[model samples]
Target: MVRSNAYDLPTISVQGEIDHPRLRSLGFVDPSGHAQLVALGTSGIAYDVRIGDRAVGWAADHVEPGVSIRHSDVEANLALAYNSCVGNRAIVVSGRAQGAEGVVTGKHGGALPTDRLLVDFSPDVLDKLVIGDSILIRSRGQGLVLPDHPGVSVRNLDPNLLDRLPISEVGGVLSVGVAARIPARVMGSGIGMGSVALGDYDINLFDAQTVEEFGLDRLRLGDLVHLEDTDNRFGRSYRKGMSTIAVVAHSDSVLAGHGPGVVTLFSGSDEDLVAVDDPAANLADIWRV
Candidate 1:
């Protein structure tokens, strides 16, 4: 397993809650210029549903505001964002859900002032978790490195999660198991970001033809998906002969230029990533989460 040289990274604590931001107009125009009012972003209990649950929905399935934390301390929030990675351990330090543990599933940026970081807790504990609860993160996924593959870049992923992934070195090449293969041309929204460690990108499911062709409708919330012809090293951009492996963070959205969200695990170029199919190719299954 890949481990950081410096094992003394400081554990940082940042608190957030379910934010009920007032919207003058909940109505939004879809990609087809159709009006929609879908409830999304933070709070409420999302049940044991998986991806592809509600292909036609006004809300993001299986992802709600368990706790949202960001403050005027932009630098500090950014640091917390950078330190916390997918699959890291998170404990409810305060509130009724105190001592309960969960996993960091994904992160959202610029969406809300305080709801930047998005985490996932089991349904049983969600009710106990209220807004403004203290969340202590055991942040330790920053210094991960693929010692063998110098070209691939890793971000917002725990090394332990990486180990559980079915990535293997066979015949001097790495094979990554993915639930589905998506085309880079379909990638929309949240691109050109300097770092995915702080946020995630979305796969626009607005095109009916593309969704049917790629089998994206079967994606699960934590499924590991492969995006062909995409490079997210410096920014989310289309690059031929490049591919990125990411985990689905959120559910499908009816909003314009938005769909299921995905955070980058690592990216490789020159056709180094080989896509293989596996039904259990998801974070929840990997760690038995």
Candidate 2:
């Protein structure tokens, strides 16, 4: 078994409310220079979209599936983003959906006013949810460390989920199963950010050729993807022979330099962290949601 310091990690409570969807009056321009407007940004409860839904082909930009949540206060929202981890438990504390349970899925970070936390809930629960409903997240898993593999850094992943991952160690090398292996060149927006603790960077699918070659169109919202030659340790950057594993957080965008959002989960050198193809390597599949 892989050893970790997960047991020593402390869990905290962070509260947030369902965020309302946003749209700019001026609309947006796509990569082809076409001015267009559509449903975009964070939504209270995305009824048609869920963890296993297709991320591409959506008429939205940076659109979060399921429920998008954030604290009304800026500083508190920051805490909610930084402290919450994927696979953490979320509870609806107020509103018609009170007592409903969900799972923290991912975080949205980019050129936005605030970072939003994504949560996955059942359809019935989502139907009852409304904008501004309070949610209490049992946040944990920030300071996680693999005792045997010092080169690998873990971020934004819950300890319980970590234990259930399709991970195996052989000859001091950790092999992690992922849904897709994305090239580093496709990474865009939020690229130069100095922190991976909260939010996410984009996966650029603007190039049709690259998209076909990578089969990126098939990418789903909860899929685990490996970023080749990427380093998200301190910030997002290209480091030779490095690898970063991240989860697809939000849907595709019509704008340039932006596509589906992916939040960092693990980072290290290719020698230390190897990616293995596993089609079922998705959060939705793992959790059977």
Candidate 3:
């Protein structure tokens, strides 16, 4: 994995330029009942059709809630070896079915996907696997960069709340920035859901009622939302000048290779977020005092 300065937020960078004469779409299904083409990351091909600001759920090709398969499901000729692994692809480097392969899957709890890609391994191989084992990933997509926008900022976040954010009932849906113009989707997993506080957010797709009530239908990808920042370490507060902001990027969990939606602390400190009615306000405009 690439590393940056501690103060400099981490981001992905592409190794080479892609100059395909004719690009194709991923034909991904969004949570809002729409079919759209999507980029795996900022480095991949850019799409033409834009979606609304509502948070939509997305996944790497072939990922589901309870579906497990072998790495051969996606790749046919994967080699099995110790530490000769790829980043997001899955390979059965060791065990009874030592040669079997799986998708790189993702990282959460104590287990992480071999490559940034999801790996599918046979149940037999999975059962014999132990912690500290290595897998492989055939990394794709363009490089990602931590966006540099005043509307977005980051701080030490409460892990518990990150895990508790609601999930969208509709496919590929998530609640994003306050504006209604940005277009982005959610994807992936291991965003510390089920775990709280060590720097995770339970980001989920907002329901229809909340989406309408908050005028979320107007939001677009890349729009920044100034979350009601607060000092309360345990719960949420909606006060003026007491909120932080995050940008709506992909519609995926923060864990694994998927990018997490972010709220930066550019204007205020952790304590600056207080209580208020509009929790997702662009405070930079109203709170600049």
Candidate 4:
């Protein structure tokens, strides 16, 4: 018999907010001719699109007709650890294609899916990807786990703003880092929003204007947000002093039930963090001892 919670289990909590006054003006309307106040489903979340070697901000899928999901204020993934791997190498661990390898385009976030390390292969290679298949990432930069450093923290972020912010780079690399820790209680609707109940948290990356205007820019993509240890049932706190780590990716995706970018990693119990004002600080400077 197939066991449930085997792969991609849900372990987070989500709440809805009804303060979107501009949603209707943007053409979102209900059947009553008023601004449609639909519950932002798990489709509104998204991840930063990495085209070549750039973080292209956040992009969500269709929410309503004519209301295309644009790059809004959102947070990027934080808590990144560099592994020992070269570029363009593939490492397949899970799924039916276990032992199969793909090309490593580059690393984006700290973890795997949440910190989505981009891997490119032929269409035939992608065809082998299964739902429960775990990717064995290999390279000179592999298995670099996020340290429970006291200087790091994260908060709930908005995705819309992440799509608009200008790109920042360091040593020709994208300059992204975590700002603070956020409880899973603040995550909203999107594909992984359902996965939140599975002990995962979505990352946001945007600007402040988007936060006040559409609440999108409040976060950026690379923010290292924290997930409170809690029971998926009743959405109650489980480990009073424990938590997990995930990087914000996006709100939705082109594939069904596969929106947003998430990379999950096992964290220790006493991983404390603090907030920083500028998230775009150079990685070398911030992580410097």
Candidate 5:
């Protein structure tokens, strides 16, 4: 197991809140099948269209009901936001849920207020957790990589999580098993960003017919996805000879150009990329969270 010296990075506890401000989706309908006047502002539940019941969450990417985190130091907050990968452990350090253990199911970030982390716990744990409770994420996997493939750069990933995936070289190609393969062209909102660690990018699932055609509607929270013709080693950009793998971090949005947000996991050039179908390619299934 390739581990990091900072694997035991100081655990930081941040407070949670229901931070939803009034949002206006001018002249558009979200995936919820309605034009809403006011979006729900609360934590612990997702309000939007989702793929499967077994999915860890169904929260929308930008504006949805989920736990929100904020820190005074920008660097520490960014580190907390960037290094923490989905499926990583999150512990409740204070308030009603003190000593409770949970798994990071997803993360949503953009600007102020809407930025938040989504964690899934048992019903009992949820009942115990309250606003302002301390959620501590044991941050790790900041600069992850595939040692064998010097060409690939991994980010926002947990090495233990990566090792769990059954990766193999078949016929001289790196075949990665995923719940589904997404075309790079369909990726929208945050295309020209620098690096995948800072935040997550959304998949554009606006066209209902197109979504059904590509089978993108089957995407579930925590499912790993293979992005076609994309690269994110240095920064997220589109190139013919590039490829990237990311996780489904949040649910579909009503906002015009947003869908399930994906946090990067592995990225490399096309020569080293290959993807195949695996029905059980989800973090929830792999980690049994």
Candidate 6:
């Protein structure tokens, strides 16, 4: 069995409020040079979008599924984004939806407007939510380590979720099931970020052929994706024989170099970590959120 230092980790409380969605004053221009003005970024509560929904073809740019939040203070917001792990429990502490429970579904590194955390909630709870509502998350799992597989680094994934992943180790190689494999070359925005725990990079879908070739057009919000020839240990970059595992946290974008946002979950050398295709390999299915 795969083991980690999960039992020894500390789970802290981090608080944030529903963030206000904002669009650029003049809007943005697409790759086709078309200026578009639409709903974009950080909606307090998304009633229709859920974990298993499609990530592409949204009328929005960098759309975050479920509820989005941020701390009013810059430093605190940074902590909220960096510390909260996917699968962490989030509870509403204020507003009409007080006491409502949700799951931390994804995190977006300030790709466009601001950095935010995505939380999935029931439709009834969403109906009662409002902007500025406070949420408290029990944050943990940032420094998770696979003791038997030191080469594989775990980040931004909850220990509980990690325990549930279909992971197996044999002959010095760790195999994980993923919904899809993303080519490293198709990666865009947030590529040069110095840290993976703070935010997620985008999957560039500007090239229709590449998107189709990789079957990315049907990507879902909580899908587990494998990044081929990708490295995120120190920073985001391409290293031969290395791969990274990430979860789709946000929606598709019309902006150049910006598509669905994905937060890193695991990364290691190809020799030590391997991915097996399993169409059912997604957070929505695994976590049952």
What are the lDDT figures for the candidates, one per model?
A: 0.69, 0.90, 0.30, 0.30, 0.65, 0.88
What number of clashing residue pairs does each candidate have, in the order they appear?
4, 1, 89, 97, 1, 0
Extract clashing residue pairs from model 5: 30-254
- Rank list by lDDT: 2, 6, 1, 5, 4, 3
Model 6 scores a C-alpha lDDT of: 0.88
True lDDT of residue 72, candidate 5: 45
Runs of candidate 6 exceeding 4 Å displacement: 111-113
Tens-digit per-residue lDDT, 1-289, candidate 6: 6788998899999999898877557576789999887655556678888989899998767778889998878888888888999999999999888999999999986642367889999889999999899999999998888888899988998999887887878887889999999999989988888888887899999998998999999999999899999999988998889999999999888878889989998899998899999888888898676
State the lDDT of candidate 4 residue by residue for 45-143, as single tens digits: 112222121222223231211001111212311211123121323455555555665433222222232323334334444456543344443323222
State the weakest 10-residue window (summed lDDT) of model 4. 62-71
lDDT: worst 10-residue window of model 5: 48-57
Candidate 4: stretches off by over 4 Å: 1-48, 51-59, 62-177, 188-216, 228-238, 252-261, 270-278, 281-289
Report the number of the highest-TM-score candidate.
2
- Give the 10-residue window scoring lowest on summed lDDT in candidate 6: 108-117
lDDT of 2 by residue, 22-53 (tens): 65575767789888876665667889888888
Top-scoring candidate (lDDT)? 2
Error of 1 at 58 (Å): 5.7
Q: Candidate 5: where are CA atoms >4 Å away?
A: 1-36, 41-66, 72-75, 112-114, 170-173
Q: What lDDT is reached at residue 195 by model 1?
A: 70
Per-residue alpha-carbon lDDT of model 3 for 1-289, expressed as tens digits?
A: 1111233323221111111222356565555566766544321122321222233434332111111222222122122111111122334454344555543212111122121122334445545654334333333211212232222232322222222222121222122234422112221233323321111122333344544555554543333454443321222233343444443433333233333333222223434222233333332222121
- Rank order (by TM-score, best first): 2, 6, 1, 5, 4, 3
